[model samples]
Target: MPLMNWDSSLDVGVDKMNDEHQQILSLMNHIYDAREAGRSGPDVIALVDRLGQVTIDHFRDEEAYMEQIGYAGIASHKLIHKDLLDKFTGYASDIKGSGGQVPEKFLTFLKLWLTAHIRGIDMKYSPKADLLKAG
Candidate 1:
């Protein structure tokens, strides 16, 4: 089974962002697959690192989109992004130092955070906020 699943509730009413979210979900699964396949510790760590980088890039893109659309909640949203990144980095660091399978708590964190962030937070900037919603 995949480590992450993207559902309709996570749709933020923007094509680009939704695509990025799907990509992130795929990367999460790749990390799980690597570990399950008994890939080297470094290999798994690298996947984790790649996930982090991809998430950072996605957040930057999302923020830029919000700015282009004049999202009123950009400042607070950016702060939330920062907090999420900090927590993600902490989990990545822990996983790297431990040198084993991804922790269950980490997986839980990813699932919960992505679900809520997209469905709850991201959706706030959707609809009237996102010009592409009408598309």
Candidate 2:
């Protein structure tokens, strides 16, 4: 089974954002699969690297969308993103510095953060977008 399944509730009512979210979830599953399969160090490292890049791109797109939509909580939203990014960056550095065995804690953190952010922060931006889409 995949580490994280895409819950319908995570849908933010934006096509692009939803797609990005799915991609992230997919990458998370890839990480889990790699660990479970006892994949080589370079294999897991490549997956992690791709995940980081995808996350960066997604955040940029989401933040830009928030700005375009005039979301009032944009500042706080950006702050949340920044904090998560910093955490991931630290984990990535550690993985690279070490022999590429990702700490289980890092996977746990990603799972928790992604779910929480989607249900909380991402949902905050969803209502207005839904309203706009409906009207």
Candidate 3:
């Protein structure tokens, strides 16, 4: 089973952003699977790097979309993204430095971050986008 499953409940009502979010969830699952399969070291490191890149790309796209739509909370939203990115980067670096044994703490952190961010932050934008789409 995948670590993180994407569903409509996670959608923000923006097609592009929703797609990016799904991709991120898929990447998270991949990482979890790798860990569970006892595949660490360079393989895990590579997966972490890919996750980092995808995260950065998704955040940039989301921020750009917010800007285009003149979302009032864009600044705060970007800051949240930055904080999350920093956390993820730290995790990746720590794993790489440790020769690829990802700490249990890091896995827990990922799960918590994904759950909170998706349910709280991401969902907050959904209503507005849905209204726009309906119009």
Leading candidate by lDDT: 2
Decoy 3 TM-score against native:
0.89
Rank the models by TM-score, top first.
Answer: 2, 3, 1
For model 1, what is the error of residue 67's alpha carbon versus the real structure, in angstroms, after optimal superposition? 0.5
lDDT of 1 by residue, 1-135 (tens): 887778877787789999999988988888777766766477788888999999999999999999998989999999999999999999999988988458778877888888889877898788634555565
Top of the candidates by TM-score: 2
lDDT of each: 0.85, 0.88, 0.82
Q: Which clashing pairs does model 2 show?
A: none
Q: In model 1, what is the error at residue 28, expressed in angstroms?
A: 1.2
Question: Comparing candidate 2 with candidate 3, which one achieves the higher TM-score?
Answer: 2
* TM-score, cand. 2 vs. native: 0.91
Rank order (by lDDT, best first): 2, 1, 3
TM-scores, one per candidate: 0.87, 0.91, 0.89
